[model samples]
Target: MKRIHAAPGTISPVGPYSQAVISGHLVFTAGQIPSLGSFDEQPESFKGQVRQTFANLAAILETAGSSLSHIVKVNAYLTDPAQLEPFNEVYREILGHAPPARTTVCVQLWGVSLEIDCVAELIAKENGQ
Candidate 1:
């Protein structure tokens, strides 16, 4: 069986998808963008966008009974390659020691500067399983 997770404070999905789905010990999160309220209100700087994106991802993971420390893999998409350095700086601060394996690529995002999706281990079993 699988469990779906959504946080009321986090941005609602813009498409047909849950914020995250937990199956077994793994939590899979949908790609997160830097929209705390609405897509139109995204941060102007790449650094700001990256920070917001990570915050969104963290919220979804927390809702799924996981955390950034438990993340095993991440996939990041950036609209510009030049944003990589700033993104890395924020990523290191948020992830801290023993960061997850990550793959980042330059891609065209409509309005946001970047998007991130991740997979993490559940910190605890639901209802003790």
Candidate 2:
């Protein structure tokens, strides 16, 4: 069985998808964009966008009973190749030494410069079920 999750305070999905879904011990998150409030508004700086995207990803994972530290893989998309260094800097700061495996690629995006999605290990629920 699978469970869908939506994190409070995170931007709602712009399409017909849940923020994250869990099956077995794994939780997968939807691609999170740099929308601080509404999807119409995006951060101006590439660094800011990346930070917010990770923040959103963390929130979604937490909602699904996981966390940034539990992430095993990440898929990131960027509109500009120049942003890669800055994105990496922020990624290191957020994920620390044990960062997950990641792949980042330059791609055109609508209204935002970057998007990120991840998979993480789910924490056991109360009662150990």
**6-116, model 2: which lDDT tens digit per residue?**
588786777888888787899988899988888877778778888888888878887788899999999999888888889899999988679889898999988788889
Per-model TM-score, in order, reads 0.90, 0.90
lDDT of 1 by residue, 1-129 (tens): 465546756867777888898888899999989987877877888788888888888888887888889999999999888888999998999886988899999999777789999999989665675
lDDT winner: 1
The per-model lDDT (C-alpha) reads 0.85, 0.85
Clashes of 1: 0
Mark the regions of model 2 whose C-alpha exceeds 4 Å error after superposition. Answer: 125-129
